[model samples]
Target: MGLIELPAELRLNIYEYFLLRHTRIKGGNQPNNSHLALARVCRTIHIEATPLLHTYISLRTEHQISKFVYHVDASRCNVVTWADVANDGRVMLTPQSSPVSRLFLALRKMTGLKCLRVFDCKSGVRAPDGPRFHGRVILKSEEAMFPDDGAMARSTPIETYKLCVSPTTRSTLFTNIPPTHICTLRLSGDCIFPDASDFSSLRELILDAVTGNHFDRRALDSTFTSSRLETFCYRMGGMGSLELRDSHLESLRTGIGTTIRRLALVGCSRLTGNGLAALFDQLRNLTYLALDMITVRQLQVGFIRVLSPKLELFKFAITNVSYAQPLIAEEVMLCDEIESLIDRDQPPQSMHLKLRDEVLQSSGRWAKWETMVKHRGIDLRTGVWGTEELQ
Candidate 1:
């Protein structure tokens, strides 16, 4: 029997396996030829696969947005559940005739859009129109782009919103969103902290590389305590002027510590091992824990041991050790304990350990730890000094 001669349900499963892979557009400008090729196999297959192809739409440039609006029909537009608008360094906040206005017009047509991400490139972007750009031009332009309150009410509510734009532009953009419907919020770059009252329905909060200068201590504390957040990730980039301290961990412990399942604190150098141990002790319900490039003090083993028994995955990366202090016996024991924890067939199904070359050279026990890590089939990553800086 031919492939098309098979049952409809079986054919749909095969199409989904291939078509679902392209649902998330990850920093790319090119379309997958194989997905497009599969959609063109036959009339029946094309009818079944075309909707899947258009399920997740990513428009990176002004031309792409314009093409999508003009080419995609209403039926295909209705099938789109997620849309990403990444203006790769282009001046989007211009006059009413700008690309952003066109992009919003396209968004209005996507009746099924449940998630929207508006992010920009890290560098190479030009400055705004002028000093008056943000105060007047950008606000006026955004007003024209975003739908009115009545129109937004009629449209499908977006559940997830991810933003990576300049700090000044964040507030104006947020005003357009229906705050009550947003369940997940991901903020990247140097954006200001969000007010908790604005997103009453927020469940998962992710802050990636956000600077601490814009964060208000009182606002952050209230946000954690007030919101019913389930998953929280705060990853700081570089050595900022302000870092998350032990007091912040206290806030987390008192706030959502009992309810949170997954937590990641990367590059939070100010968080001591003792503070983390205290926080982990309170977080009895945590299932996944990731601590990358965090400061490890005397309580290295204590903190790791305090991890919740419900934990399923642990990712830990060691920072560069000073020649003055050298590797202590506790640090070596910490490694041994981690290996034993992974060896057990309990809650933590997977464990990852990252070490610096200098750290391995500082102690021979770490080499033995590396062997044990390999024997236990734990994921291990190693890096040299200055490698991250160059990248």
Candidate 2:
């Protein structure tokens, strides 16, 4: 029988398998060029696989975007669901090849898009020792910028995407972001974040690697705190001393401290022990908490108290944290106590506690806690130093 003689669903499955045979996913997805080649076999096969191939595209330049829209299938441009922009590790913001206007046009064509991921390859592509390069770009707003061509303006919209880009060129696409449809908005790196009031339907927000110099404190006032958010992941960066015990953190407490369900933080070393203690003491509705890379020289065993009655998951990463040896040892003891409490018919029996990082010191207490929580279904993960599988 001929290849087209197979059932439609089975043929589609086989075609997708072959189309993505070259795709790979590590820290992020690697580009695949097989879609271009597979389209050459026949018109029927090409027409069938065009939308499937465009669904998860990793385009990084204007040339690639134009070529994709012109050659692959012009009709499928709006049909794309997930798009990864600035993924080619290009150093220049608007390289000589990919114009920013062209990128804006490419985004305009994606009317049915559900997830859009943006990456600024400046740091990842070029190291500090590389040739010095400097440029800035910003996203501007316009009425007809998003969902252009009168295609599904309010009917179909993007849902959630953790976009990380350096927008300083004053382009007119930032205002086009769907405020009511977006559920998660993650801004990584220092850039002027949009007002929280804009995300009228936002559910979770991640301010990853954002710092103080460019941060707008007024944005996090009533407008931001009033958003219907359940998760907030704030992994801060920079050498500024403005992150600890400030009105910003207090503003969060005063606004939605009792409503946030999951909270994650990478507070700076400047946050004092008192500040750390004051953190968990404010929230009353958290079910999951993750804190990493913090320096708590005086964080005693009692400091890990969960003020939330609904606390279910408490994840702590101690790889880069600067804590005392006794504090680390007591952490193990506390895990043992948690297991004891859970085994004795505690309230959080169905809860999950995950302790991540390479925190196994010479005291040999790591293995003791590791084995104690194995049968109890609690997660006690000791991160490996490098990539050795246990040897």
Candidate 3:
């Protein structure tokens, strides 16, 4: 039998494979010939395959966004579920702009969208004085150009969304978004957003630094504590040490507590070892952990002693790991105070530590760490550690 003469299910599988031929090209006027050929075959095939072609999209410019709506069949947006708008991390700040608003208007038409990411837009004005650097993007209320169709507002199944913005804005862009449809909210800003509690079903939360004078650890805690968040990640930029003490992390136990499975606090420096140990004690089901700043004592307590046996991956991002020698030695050393690292029934499967080439060669610490990681039988992952120039 011919391909189309076969069962309807098998024909659909072929059409799906042909039209959704994987490509990461962000913007273009038309899909490649492979996708076009499938649509041009017959009326029924065109109806079925057109939606599959619009399943994934990445738009960079407002021109691209406008062109997207104009190019694609409005009915084809029925199958579009995942969108990555401007994934490139650049400052897209055009003053007196309405493109972002228009972009939101276009997104409202996609009834089947489940996930969206809008990252690294600069919405801050140039600072008048002091340091000359302003914060990240901040969306205003006027940016809500979404159509007021009650059916469209109530029907979208969009669950996970990420928006990166500045801290000082008086209003937010995603404020009008349907809370019932949103489960994961990734908001990057400097200060604590006052209306975070509005998203009643929010499960996963991410917070990031966007400006100066907004690094209070309590603010990070308050944001995640909005709902029974199952995953929490915080990224701190620019340099400075931070202490995760009672004042900062105490609320975590009562707020998120045993529900959290994945936790990452990256680029922050000098975490108080004991406070982290106490924090570790609460997260008994943690499966993955990533961090940049950690002391030898914290390593001994948190990773060696306190971490759950269910942990599958542990990653350390090295900036200034002068204490790595003791850290490696301590990991290899059998502790009379606690169980041996080798005696674990379900040890982590992978451990990754990314560092500079100079730091790795310093005093043969890298070799020792490799040997220890081998003995522990972990799949070692030192991704692109040798590429960056040493400071």
Using TM-score, give the best candidate's number.
1
| lDDT pick, better of 1 and 3 | 1
List TM-score per model, in order. 0.74, 0.64, 0.64
Q: Tens digits of per-residue lDDT for model 3 on 1-391? A: 8766888788789876664454322322222234455677888777776666667665555566667677767776667786655422222234533323346645766778887765433231232233332443344442433424222354765688765444432224344455555688765443334444455577786754444333353444455444676777766544432333344555676565457788877755555546667777788888887756634443534434777778887765644346644454433231321223324677678766665566566567567666766777877777633211100
In model 1, which range of ten residues has the least summed lDDT?
Answer: 382-391
RMSD of each: 5.9, 8.2, 8.7
The alpha-carbon lDDT assigned to residue 285 of candidate 1 equals 82
Give candidate 1 regions above 4 Å deviation: 1-38, 41-45, 87-100, 121-136, 139-147, 165-173, 193-198, 219-221, 239-242, 296-301, 321-330, 343-347, 356-391
Candidate 2 residue spans exceeding 4 A from truth: 1-53, 87-100, 121-155, 166-174, 193-196, 212-216, 219-225, 237-248, 272-285, 307-312, 319-364, 367-371, 384-391
Total clashing pairs for each candidate: 0, 7, 3
Expressed as tens digits, the lDDT of each residue in 260-317 for candidate 2 is 7887766544444345556567776777766654545644444355345566665554
User: Relative to the true structure, how large is the alpha-carbon lDDT of every model?
Assistant: 0.62, 0.53, 0.55
**Model 3 misplaced stretches (Cα beyond 4 Å):** 1-53, 86-101, 120-142, 145-152, 165-174, 190-192, 212-226, 239-246, 294-303, 318-343, 354-376, 383-391
Candidate that scores best on lDDT: 1
The TM-score between candidate 3 and the true structure equals 0.64
lDDT, model 3: 0.55
